[model samples]
Target: MSIMTQLEFELEFSQSEKQIAKYILNHGEEVLSMSVKELAKETYTSPATIVRLCKKIGLEGYNDFKIKYSAELQYDLHHTDRIDVNFPFSKDDSYPMICHKLSSLYQEVIADTIKLIDFTELNKIVDLLYPHQHIDIYGSGNSLLAAMSFQHKMMRISRDVNLRILHGEQVFMSYNSNSSRIAMIISYSGETNENIQIAQTLKENNTPIIVLTSVGDNRLSHYADYILNIGSREKIFTKIAPFASQISIEYLFNVIFSCIFQKDYEQNIQNKISYDKKNDFRHPLSSPVSDEIK
Candidate 1:
């Protein structure tokens, strides 16, 4: 996890830690320039407390933590210059410029998401999913759209994926789920109340729940059997759209689909051929209208 993400996760555990984390996050640049004593004085804590917090987060001391944190902050600043979510496109940007910025943003977010993924945990999720009798996917709005895409791809491979878009239906389906069922709950913030409620329902029913959420601490992670993080660096002022999160979700889903398909490659191909032959239709010829412009 990134420093920001780690801080967010730590916030849910302790108040003193939260105070330190909040101060560092809000004044990262200042923290980089300050000494351990200065930071302690700034956050109204002692130097020993700062060292303990640093060690808790895996650093040897405040100096080591500050160095690592500065490196990450510098990297973020360098990479996020042009494709910032808050200032995605300037008014002076031409169409081509806008397209380039958008493409670059997608590439960056996808690469960042890849770095955050744990292959071992991902493969475990796939292992858990492969043997399940039913797959229940829960989401709302744009997330539901991603869920439907997963549903379609899974169905093409002859897997039964149930998508519940409505809040009540999600609860109902989760309530009916069993041990043989797997629930995938997707939310950009991972704090959606309805999704959290559905996750609770799935847990109560003894169904394993997997969560795909933005990279940070959130309420939904508490209920998850497996947590997959999606990298999205959108700021509060950049709530104009969920572009980064959506792309990350879709990219992750595509990866999962590819893994599942590779496991049953030949069978999946045959299934595709069979389904296409049954559903595909050709438009009848229109008397060679290409040559005559009547």
Candidate 2:
């Protein structure tokens, strides 16, 4: 997986780390020269985190990365990218910056996520999953979290949703799957060795395979009966987190479920109402429904 993909996997990183990342993206050359101690003082993060950040930026260590970056700045100098003035350099101290950063990311994801949102492909995936007795989800490396999250949602509606997060055991368990089941593999790169292998294994066994990946044209998709492509993200050099990417995928699942649920909306509502009546799951609102016409 790419370094950016790994960035996406760090779903639980602190706001401070995000702030550090934002600062670095805005000023990479300056920070690249700074020692871990100095960078921590500037970013208000610990030296330990600075080392982690170095790794996050696809570097071996601070010294090695700084040397290369310093050389590049001196050697193959390129034209500067126009910094978006809207992102005011001094507007945020810390927490507000996180919100602004997230807001910007959300907007970008919405824009790129729409460019190739093929309803046809999405509907095809829905079809593949709709009537299946069991649905198996597979994702390795960074995307394993996404795979597990999807399985959680689907399992609410599906009694048999197989989520294979453990790579070795997943491969072992996949072969034992009944012929009636459908498998969906999640990979942002669409090139994860484990994901590709799982897709291949499923394809060879005649199990229907659905692939959810960023790039539509990949080896895994070649074997899939359905391809639901998410956001088309350009590579970011600083570090890329899949916050927006995962959001898009989760949105896709929600849309799919909404469509499926709409098929029998009336009955579904009735069932809910009946269940609430029996279980007292319904909450009484401050403004209650009236029996008589207003």
Candidate 3:
């Protein structure tokens, strides 16, 4: 977890510690240059209390905390582009301004998603998915749409992916799936009741489960053999829409599809081209003159 996320989500700190955390969050760049005593004075606490807060968050001491926190702050400043994930635009904005804000939001979400990826875990997920002829995906709403998009991409490459939109069918699919099939569960909150039940059911069948979720601890992550974190800056119920979560989920799915394609690059490329040519039915005005694979 990033230091900023830990500070925002962790609730074990005392009042003073939370105050210090708030100060750091509000003035992250400023905090990067502050000494332990200076930070303590600014937060109206003692240096020892500051050190205790650092320890509580799993750092060795004030110095260690500063080192890690500074790196995270620097990365955010450079890559986040300072765009708000939850409410990227306001009512008074012009069309161009709205376009710019939405574009920046997409870029920021992708950057954040990239930072959260664990390459080792990603490799493991791709390895597990590559050998499976059929995969099962479980999600709801926007997440389900992202899964369907992924399913479409994999299908072009001669891989089968199943998704059940109805709750009863989802439950039945979970029960029927066994260890031979791999299941991917996508839940932004990572605490969705139905997703948890599916994860539990899949676990009982000894199936390997890959979970795509937001950062922080949640019930769904406990049952995952591997977890991929999406951009997590938006509120569960307060957003205009799930702009960040939806884009992040789609980007992650694209990454997974790309990685899987890379596993057998030549064959997958040929497979897609072959499928496209065989299914082509466009008129001359809309389609390429020659349907040759280049």
TM-score of each: 0.74, 0.60, 0.73
Candidates in order have lDDT scores of: 0.78, 0.63, 0.86
Ranking by lDDT: 3, 1, 2
Tens digit of per-residue lDDT, candidate 2, span 1-294: 233333443434677767666666557578766778888898888888867765655578778657755754553254133222123224444877766766766666666566767888877767766777588777765566655666665554543677655448778666765568888777766666777777777877888877777753445667878777777443322333456557667666667666665666787676755655666534554436622222
Worst 10-residue lDDT window, candidate 1: 285-294
How far residue 67's Cα lies from its native spot in candidate 3, in Å, is 14
Candidate 2 runs further than 4 Å off: 1-93, 234-240, 273-294
lDDT for position 103 in model 1: 92
Per-residue lDDT of 118-142 in model 3, one digit per residue for the tens?
9999999999999899899998999
* Model 1 steric clash pairs: none
Candidate 1 lDDT by residue in tens digits, 156-266: 887899876554887788778888888888876666778888888888889898999876456788899998898757542235577777788888898888898889899
State which candidate has the highest lDDT.
3
